[model samples]
Target: MKIAIHQMNSGIDPAVNRAAMDIAIRSASNQGAHFYFAPEMSLLLDRNRERGRIHIQHESTNRHIAALCDTAREAHIWVHVGSVPVLSEDGSGRFANRTLLIDPAGQIVARYDKMHLFDVDLATGESWRESNAYAGGTHPVLAQSPLGPLGLTICYDMRFPDLYSRLAKAGARAFAMPAAFTVPTGKAHWHVLLRARAIESAAFVIAAAQSGGHEDGRETYGHSLVIDPWGEILLDMGDGEGLGFVEINLSRVDEVRAQVPVHLNRRVIPPLD
Candidate 1:
């Protein structure tokens, strides 16, 4: 099925982001896309810790989330919202960076909160303290969809291979690694990391990314991508801020796995101990 990977440069305004997404959804649906995959933080991209602290709301009550779900239902297509910043269930006043799987009926069938919090202090003097504002999720989600089984992951989670392997073993045929990757790290590791994940797991990888400069003065590396199971890049949206589409071939998952058999070749560390 055709999947539209929507790359966006969302700012602090939820309304503007939603409007852009709405247009993309309609355009993708018109082009016969079965699914729409939006970049992480598709609703808003505010780097001001103080502002973001006040901006997040519970998913059930968040109008931005409701609006996106409505768009999915109206378009009659599945949508993988890379994530939404929401109130954590613990009620610690911290939010969760959560990914939701909205079916064609606009019902949320699965949700994956990002487990890894980005807490890096960059050499360029850029520092992020995601843990201060958001709580990390413990569980991994491998969701079953009409198109295929998808292993859901957020930006920082892409750096971990064990999660992808676990999802692959759980019968996931495709992986979603939506991200709002910073320009520096993205230019250095994005493609290689994604390709490695696909090659190791023998699963298709679809990554929708946030692009361009945002209201917070933070620049993100776009290059939204789709990679085959064989690690070949099938599509790259480049640095532009727009929605792009690609055809997902599930058969390649099996074909590449059969050829490499990395899944079966994994050896036990201490004689299966």
Candidate 2:
């Protein structure tokens, strides 16, 4: 399938971010892509909680999401909206970093809340407490796409192999990992971890990432990548803000699995002695 990945340097305004997404989706469809993928926080990337709260509303009332669905319908392309912050349905006054998969007909096919929250203090003094504002999702999501079953995950979720294993066992052939990675971590672990995930699952890994400096005073490492089942880099949009396209052969999943047979041979091990 032909896919378009939109690498972005999103700012603090929700309206501006929504407009960028609209253009990218329409352009992707016009360029003959069947599916369009975007980075995390595609709609809003504001770090100011006070300001962000003004725009973060319940999914039912989020006008930006509604506009995106219409864009997908008008463009006639499937959309993997990396992740957006939405008010949690539970009245905890917290938000959920959610991924929405929209079909060509503009219907939501699946929704995945980011299960693993990022809470860390880096040596670079980049401390992030995701759980402070957002709640974690309880389940992993597997949704059917034109390319096959697609596994949905957000930024920090990439570090957990167990999630990918579960998705693969459940018949996911490709994984969408949308991220807004800090420069330090991205420089050290991004490519390696993504390649590892693809190799271990023997599945395709499509990662569209936020790049460069942002209006919120944060800089991100931008290399958006598309890795095949064998861990081959198909397309790498290096540290820039734009769209990257790639065509993937679904049959490669079976080819690699047949050669290695890791999926079939996997065993349920007892608690490590």
Task: Report the number of the highest-TM-score candidate.
Answer: 2
Per-candidate TM-score against the hidden true structure? 0.97, 0.99
| TM-score for predicted model 2 compared with the true structure | 0.99
Per-residue lDDT tens digits for candidate 2, residues 132-234, read 9999999999999997999999989999999999999999999999999999999999999999999999999999999999998999999999999999999
Model 2 regions more than 4 Å off:
none
Model 1 segments beyond 4 Å from truth?
271-273
Task: Note the clash tally of each candidate.
Answer: 0, 0
Model 1 scores worst on lDDT over the 10 consecutive residues at 264-273
Clashes counted in candidate 2 amount to: 0
> What TM-score would candidate 1 get against the native?
0.97
Global lDDT scores for all candidate models: 0.90, 0.95
- Model 1 RMSD, rounded to 1 decimal: 1.5
- Measured by lDDT, the strongest candidate is 2
